[model samples]
Target: MTFSAVARSADGDSFGVAVASKFLAVGAAVPAAEAGVGALATQAFANLAYRPEGLSLMRSGIEAAATVNRLVTADAEAQTRQLGVVTASGPGATFTGEECLPWCGGVADDGYAIQGNILTGPEVVEAMQVAWLAGDPATSLARRLLAVLAAGDRAGGDRRGRQSAAVLVVRPGGGYGGTSDVEVDLRVDDDPAPVEGLERLLRLHELYFTRPDPATLLDLTGDLAAEVTERLSRLGHPGEPDAALAAWAGMENLEERLAPGRIDPVVLDLLRKA
Candidate 1:
């Protein structure tokens, strides 16, 4: 019913996961991460407690393998569970329950773990690794991990077929209102093309939800504004001084830029029509 993969950038600055299943609400049950801590994905008879408890373990200096050992060892139903963990320092570990369905297994390494159960075969995991190996860090981890998830689909993803898909990422200070973990937590709970739907949301997250620093504004003026406005107009947006950008000099999407509150009119004016 589930197939999932977890990975981190070689430098340890980013981490992510991609999962899909015939089951409902996979994200809420499968993925968890903490900035400066680590990530954990619990499934195949998932013990939901592992999500929080694993991160707590990592936060207290437990490495990936040890953290996983502690969790599985403490669980009375360990033999029926599957788990994956990646530490902030890039230690990685994965486990698949011996009792899981056919083609259930996983791979673990220094910086990531790729796992699946009730999958097509080893091909599914292979596709995931091939995709990740080809990823470019210049891109967002959301895009990279989603690429792996998409690859799994190409190679016969969840043996039961897809219903929901999700992506999760965390960074030191990459959340709204400047607090809490969650750099990115997106899901397509029920989509005909869950991976593609998740990708579209990722694009939105990259452009708006992921804010560049205040210094980023300094480089945009004149021709740069013109270029950006052209890009916005092509995306069904108005290149004008809208309320959305009142806090800065740009045209911002209403739903995305409204978070910090104020709409910077000057920023909007500058962002309007170059």
Candidate 2:
């Protein structure tokens, strides 16, 4: 009832999973990752234990294929389960049990795995693999994963239909405020178009949580500064423009993009729309 991709960043600093399905809250069941360790997706009678246990194995120096072998070999229900695993190094691995519903299978390469069960056809997994291989390595792992998921979705995802989707990426100090390993974790628990919803949430996440690109910073000056001041005043923040902008950004959870003597284009656009 689901399709997923698990991958490590080209630089080996990140690991992530993106998945969508007709299942309710597929995110809660299918995807898990740990910074500097590995990632996995367990579905089709998914054994939730595979998540933590698989990461622990990878953390202990086990490669992805071996970790998968250990998990499935020990499970009595292995024939009904499907899993995908990828580590920071070594080849990725995917498994589709013989008893899984029709149109179930997977593919894996050195850095990624794509898998699905109860899917529309082999095309779903094939499209995802193509997207992953073609994605620019310079892009964030989260974005690349999402692109793969979207490709699978476009190619006809779960044979049942779409109900939920999620993307999870991890890297050391990659979470908000650098306090955690979760780089991006967004979910659409129940949506008619969950992949598209996930995409919108990712864009918002980048704007609010990521630091502003130095090259895109605009110095506060001339008409731009005057317009910013006017907008702040209208938003009931009539004060030094910079201070008011800071206060407003704090309220909107956009403080990460704040910089002295400059404005992020995203912030400026939000202020204009406000």
Candidate 3:
């Protein structure tokens, strides 16, 4: 039993999926997406092939509905599978097979799709849709998807309870080292509170992967510089404040937050607190 959504960013630059299930490692089986193509989730006897095949079909210029229809129609156990699809710059589509368990269904709208099987009630999907549609378009897709997934969980989620949760978001040159599209791919495979665990991981992901806004950069100077120098010296750093700050950030794996010639405000705060 699972509840999931496949969505594209309002700016058409990102796509992702967020899912929660009473199944172990639901992310490994339920969700798939590519930067410029589309995203989908297959549950309720999920056909793993739908992942790559559905992406291929969408990449070939198929819209969400046509791609989902083709996949569902060709499946031998079509009546037992639940599916959702959303293209990078097109509409969304969802399918819930007749043979799926009770309270199984879905909703599809422009740029997003939500679906689930063996959920508490229609409210589970409704809460997700409402949260999703009400989100700020400027918010990151990963955060938006997580917001809806959290709402669905609050609305009773899968009747069988939670065991796993995951979120995957992608954009051009968004992955580690900027050579791939996987901006974020996180999973809480067996946590009692997987959504919360997932949220924590998302925070860490942002801290390590995203660059700080220029407006948020804090220049280490004067008293702050002197204080940083003192702290660095006490921590066994032996150099100017700026160089030592860079070394500390590198040691903490926070190089992404560094600016060309300034310290990050968050880094300053972290050093102060430490």
For lDDT, the strongest prediction is 2
lDDT of each: 0.77, 0.94, 0.92
Which pairs clash in model 3? Answer: none
Decide which is better by TM-score, 2 or 3: 3
- Across residues 125-191, which tens digit of lDDT does each residue of candidate 1 receive? 8888888778887777778889989999989998888889999988767776458567899999987
Task: Please provide, for model 3 over 127-190, each residue's C-alpha lDDT reduced to its tens digit, 9 standing for 90 to 100.
Answer: 9999999999999999999999999999999999999999999899998778899999999999
Pairwise lDDT winner, candidates 1 and 2:
2
Q: lDDT of model 3 at residue 146?
A: 98
C-alpha root-mean-square deviation, each candidate: 5.5, 1.5, 1.3
What TM-score against the true fold does each predicted structure earn? 0.81, 0.95, 0.96
* Highest TM-score scorer: 3
